[model samples]
Target: MTLVKSLYAGIATASFVLAALPAAAEDDVKIVASFSILGDMVEEVVGDLATVTTIVGPDADAHVYQPSVADARAVAQADIIFVNGLGFETWSDTLISESGTEATVHVATAGITPVKVDGMTDPHAWNSLSNGVIYVTNVAAAMKEAMPEHAGEITANADAYIAELEALDAETKSKLADLPANRRTVVTAHDAFGYLADAYGLTFLAPVGIATEAEPSAKDLAVLIDQLKAEGAAALFVENITSPALVQQISEETGIVIGGRLFSDALSERGGPATSYLTMFQHNLGTLLDALAHETAS
Candidate 1:
């Protein structure tokens, strides 16, 4: 597997693939989103005008995701493929080529300047409400380009959706504003919150960096435990998509309470707390506020 270290590299590669697609049919719009989050965004814009399929399902990790034969078949039959560029879906190119998809592929992160984690650009743009708006706009633009007849409708829907995202951004700030500045520090399993931290005026500390696939050393854990104690980290939380064992151990050894389970890489399944993109943000904000509120009250 090629280790993609930068978002710009991923963008360059995606542009190359997108440049290769021939013009597609109008009514035969079939979209294959690389993961469920992008799938949700695409569905919001395209609605009934397109048939959508997601290669990675709800609560699944895209970092080390391998393409199944069925997923390859889905790509093979798609009319257009939408992906979150910036090395989010590393298996995408191989799957698309192997599946023999001649479809046009679009990057939903097209317009936004992606925030990088480590030396590479972090691909989890949907975590920030501001970035989420840009994602929706990119999806709408792609839909419009593919099916010009619905261009006006897609644009209108995107505008309405963006309005809601603007509200979400404001509401998130409002929800987080009550916590004291020192109490805003959060420790999670991975560096998934660069965007969230930048947006909400909170601080994120992870012993582990961009990938949860890696395990922190005993020394690293000890250092982190000390940092949590010295920094007076208000809460520690486990991510929905990562193992809770490390976080539980951190909580136990450090005596810092487990604040909450955060929905990080993937959204929850239908009927769950974070089924939709909006609901996911709401759930995360509520969980964080509850923990911090408890600390403040005491």
Candidate 2:
């Protein structure tokens, strides 16, 4: 049998323990994440504990992700897998099957009650810092369970990470508090920021619904343009995971200057501004504030 099958078989037969395993078995702790953003979060808590890999790379749209054979092979070898769940990767089940991986699947969204994406439950719970805290907790718990000897260390790391996330949650609310009720309306290319909007009291608007797979109808765009003009919208933004052409068209039609690009569904590649979740949130907030401040000035 393949090494993956062997690993799963061993996990099934053995009981949980807290001691270190053999040196040769160290590489067996492979982790597969659904996308770049989730991979980043998993890495922060797990640190150097495992070989982390992501199926959807930077700036890839997860809503319509199609996993490749290579991705399947990677998943098949992992000791554990982390998924955002809540229907984020619509084809995740198929990916798991194709991989033939019996690795335990851990849903990072375990405790997050996600916001609705255009009335339907969306899987992008990481948009909210509170939900991010839940994700880190779940990751730490899964790691500690799988590698028992490291339980105490993993728990301590998770606690420190939780403290940072809590601070970020507070900062988001504080940063957004300056915007008046009417000026709280924000528009973007897709419906990925429902959780962020809900958490910080912003009214989110998107011509396209839950996923970027759907194109905005011309009628919808016209309606959005009219409404934005009437409301004196503070800003419009393009998502990092989506093409900018549509957002540019909307900006041109509405005469609203395009704010800086926002990190929505994905994280930036290494060395980029939004390499981490906290940086991504701060970048988006700064962009919004700059645009709104400009509106106030003019």
Q: TM-score of every model?
A: 0.88, 0.88
Q: Name the lDDT value of residue 261 in candidate 2.
A: 90
- The candidate maximizing lDDT is 1
Give per-residue CA lDDT, model 2, range 41-98, as digits (tens): 8888778877899989887888877666567667767778998898888878866765
Error of 1 at 232 (Å): 2.0
Angstrom error at residue 97, model 2: 1.4
Question: Model-by-model lDDT, in order?
Answer: 0.82, 0.80
Residue pairs in steric clash, candidate 2? 18-148, 18-149
> Can you write out model 1's per-residue Cα lDDT over 1-298, one digit (the tens) per residue?
3433343344445555655877556577788999887888788887788899988889998887867656765776688899988888878887776555778988888877778776878888888999999899888877888889889889888888789889989999987888887788878999898889888889888878787677788899899888776666788889988988888887877778889899988889888898878888889999998887777311
lDDT of 2 at 39: 92
